[model samples]
Target chain A: EAGVTQFPSHSVIEKGQTVTLRCDPISGHDNLYWYRRVMGKEIKFLLHFVKESKQDESGMPNNRFLAERTGGTYSTLKVQPAELEDSGVYFCASSQDKQGRGNTIYFGEGSWLTVV
Target chain B: AQSVTQLDSQVPVFEEAPVELRCNYSSSVSVYLFWYVQYPNQGLQLLLKYLSGSTLVKGINGFEAEFNKSQTSFHLRKPSVHISDTAEYFCAVSENPSGTYKYIFGTGTRLKVLA
Candidate 1:
C-alpha cells in the first residue's frame, strides 16, 4: 500500500502569481487534512475533509487560499495571488476514518512553496 | 482550544548517550498524544502514541515517552541514541471528543546526535 502522495515537491513563484498543490490520499481513507510549516514556525493545521465534504476549515489563512477534495479521493490547495508570506512546506495527511484505535494519520512528503 | 509546547528548540547529545525532549500540552477535554519524527527532506513519521493504558508508551526506533497527566506532559526519551537519530521531533495532541482527530502540534525539537 502506498502512503500519501503529493505533487510538485518544490515550487517557486513570484508574488501575485497563483499556485496549486495536490495530494492523493491512501486507498480507502475517508479523512484528509492539510497543514503547513512556515520558516521558524510550528506546523499549523489548514483544513480537513471527510470524504467530499469539508469537516473543518477554520485554519484557512485567508480568502486567497482555497482547498477542494473531489470525489473524496484527492485534494488540492490553491493559493491565488500568492504572497511572500505564503512560502512554506505544505503537508497532506490521511487516516482510515475519524474513529477506532488503529486510525493513525499518515503524511506525505510536503510540497515546498517559495513565493519571491 | 488545545495547544502544545516543545520546551527545547534543539538538543545536542553524543552518540550512545541518553537524550530527552520535553513536551507539554493544555486541553480542557480528554486528548490523545502522539510523537512524530521528520528526517531530512522527508515527511513526518509516527514515533508512538498514547491513547490509553500505560503511561509509558514505547515507539519505533527505541524511543519512549511518558505521559504525565498531573504535569500535562509527554516527554520523549531514548537510552542510547545513534547519529541516525538526528531529526526533528514533534509532539502533537488531539481532542478525543467524538474523534474529531484534529491535531495541535508543538514547535518541534531538533535532535542533533554527535559522533
Candidate 2:
C-alpha cells in the first residue's frame, strides 16, 4: 500500500503571502491528520479529519491557518499572510482505524515551508 | 492533557555498541506509546509501539523499547548499533479514551552512531 503523499515537497514564500500545502492520504484510509514542527521544536498536532468532517482542530495555531477536506480523500492547509514563524515542516498522516488504538499512523515526507 | 519528554537531546555511540534513548510521559489515564525514527530527508517511520500486551516491545530495524507503566517511561534500546542507525528518535503518547487519536510528542533524541 502506498503511504501518505504530500505535494510541493518544499515551498518558499515571502511574508504576507499565501501558501497552500496539499496531502493525499493512503487509499482506503478514513483518518487523516496534519502536524507541524518548527525549528528546534517537537512535532505538534494541527488538526484531524474523519472522512469529510473535521474531528478535531484544537491544534490550529491561529485563524490565519485554514484546513479543508473537500471529499475526505485529500486535505489542504492554507496559510494566509504567512509570517516568519510559520517556517517549518508540515507533515500529513493517515490511519485506517478510527479509534487509533493499536493502529499505525503513516506519515508523509513532509512539506518544508520557508516564509521569508 | 498528556505530554512526552525525551531525556537526551543527542547521543553518540560507536558501531557495534549498545545504546539507549530515554523517554518519559505524563498522563492521568491509560495511553498508547510509540517510538518513531526519522532518517535524513525522510518522513518519520514507526519503530515500535506498546499498546497493552507486553512491557518489552520489539520493532523494525532491530530496535526495541520497554514500557514501564509504573515509572511512566518507554526507553528505546539496541544491542548493537550501526552507522545506519543514526537518526532522530521521537517518543509519542496518545490517550486511550474513546474518540481521540491526538498524539503528544517529545522534543526528540538524536542518535549518532559512529563507525
Candidate 3:
C-alpha cells in the first residue's frame, strides 16, 4: 500500500500571497491530520479530520489558514495572505480508527512552504 | 496539556559508535511515547513506540528506547549506529488519557554521524 502522498513538495511565494497544499492519505484511513514545523521549532499540530468532520481545530494558527477534507479521501490546506511566519514544512498524516500505541500514523514527504 | 523537550539540538557521533538521544516529557496524565526518524527531504517514519509492554521497547533500524516513568523520559539508543542513521529524530507523545490522536512532539535532535 502506498503511504501518504503530498503534492508540490516545495513552494515559494511572496508574502501576502496564497498557497494551497494538497494531501492524499492512505486508503481506508479515517483519521487525517495536518502539522507544521517552523524553522527552529517543533512540529505543531494544525488540525485533524475524521472523515469529513473536523475533529479538533484548536491548533489552527489563525483565520488566514483553512483546511478542508472533501469526501473523506483527500485534504487541502490553504493559506490566504500568508505571512512570513507561515513559511515552514507542512506535513500531512493519516491512520486507522485506532488510537494510542496500536495506531500507526503515516506521514507524507511534506510540503515546504517558503513565504518571502 | 503535554509537551516534549529534546535538550540536544544536534548530536555528533562517529560511525559504529553508540549514541543516545534524550527525550523528556511533561504530562499530567498517562501517555504513550514514540520515536520517529526523518531523512533528508523525507517524512517522519516510526522508529519505535512505547505502549504498555516492557519498559525497553525496540524499534526499526536497530533503534531502541527505554521508557522511564520516574524520569518522564524515553531516550533513544543505538548500540552501534551506521552512517545512514544520520537524520533528524523526534520524540513524540500520544494523548492516551484522552484517547485522542493529538501528539505532542519535541523540537527534534539532528544526529550527525561521522565517518
Candidate 4:
C-alpha cells in the first residue's frame, strides 16, 4: 500500500496570509495525525483524527490553526494570518488505528511552509 | 505528559565502527518508545519500537535499541554502521500502548558516518 502523501511540497506566504496543507493517508487507515517542526525544534503533535471525528486536539498551537478531515480519508491543515514563526515543515501521518496493535505511523514527505 | 531527551546532538563515527545514541524519557505512567530515522529532505521512518515484553528490540538497517526501565533510557546501537547510516535519529515516547499512535519525539541526534 502507498504511504501517507502530502500535497504542495512547499508553500510561501506573507504574514497575515492564509495557507492550507493537505494530507492523504493510506487507504483503509482509520487514524490521521498532524505534526510540525519549527526552527531547530523537535517535531510536535498538533491533532489526531479517527475516521471523520477528531480524537485529540490538545496539541493545536492556537485558534489560527485549523484542521479538517471531512471524509476521514484525507486531512487539511489551514493556518490563517500566518506569522513569521509559522515557517517550518508540517508533517502528516496515518496509522491503522489507536489500539497500538498496528502502532506504526507512516509519514508524508512534509510540506515546507514559509511565512515571511 | 511525556518528554524525550537525546543526550547527544551529534555523533561522528568511522565507517564500520560501533555507535550508540542515547535517549531518555520522563513520564508519570507506563509508556511506549520508538526510534525513527530521517534522511535528508525525507520524512521520518520507523526503525523500531518497544511496547512491552522484550527489553532489547532489533530494528531494520542493522540497528537495535535496549529499553532500560530503571534508567528510563532507550539507546540505539549498531555493531557496524555504514556511510548510508548517516542521518538524523529521533527517540519518541507515547503514553498509549503500541497501537495508540500519538508520539512525542526528542530533539534528535545527527549521526555522521565517516569514511
Question: Which docking class does model 2 fall in?
Answer: high
Candidate 4, A1-116: lDDT as tens digits: 78899988999889999999999998988999999999778999999999999988988999999999998889999999899988999999988854546477888989999998
Model 2: DockQ vs. true structure: 0.84
lDDT of 1 at A51: 95
Q: For model 3, what is the error of residue B31's alpha carbon versus the real structure, in angstroms, after optimal superposition?
A: 0.4
Q: Model 1, range A27-116, lDDT digits (tens) per residue? A: 999999999999878999999999999999989999999999989999999999899999999999999874565447899999999999
- Please give the lDDT score at residue A84 for candidate 2: 99
**Which digits, one per residue and each the tens of the lDDT, describe model 4 over residues B1-115?**
6899997999999999999999999998888899999999898999999989999999999999999999999999999999999999999998854344689999999999999
Candidate 1, residue A43: how far the Cα is off, in Å:
0.7
Which of 2 and 4 is ahead in lDDT?
Answer: 2
TM-scores for all candidates: the values are 0.98, 0.97, 0.98, 0.96
| lDDT of the candidates, in the order given | 0.94, 0.93, 0.93, 0.91
Query: In candidate 3, how many Å is residue B47 off?
Result: 0.1
Instruction: lDDT for model 4, please.
Output: 0.91
Q: Where is the poorest 10-residue window by lDDT in model 2 chain A?
A: A96-105
Give the share of true interchain contacts found in each model.
0.71, 0.77, 0.74, 0.74
Q: What's model 4's lDDT at B92?
A: 92
lDDT tens digits, residue span B13-113, model 2: 99999999999999999988999999999999999999898899999989999999999999999999999999999999988764547889999999999
Which prediction has the highest lDDT against the true structure?
Answer: 1
Clashing pairs in 3: none
Candidate 3 per-residue lDDT, tens place, B1-115, comes to 6999999999999999999999999999888899999999799999999878799999999999999999999999999999999999999998775545888899999999999
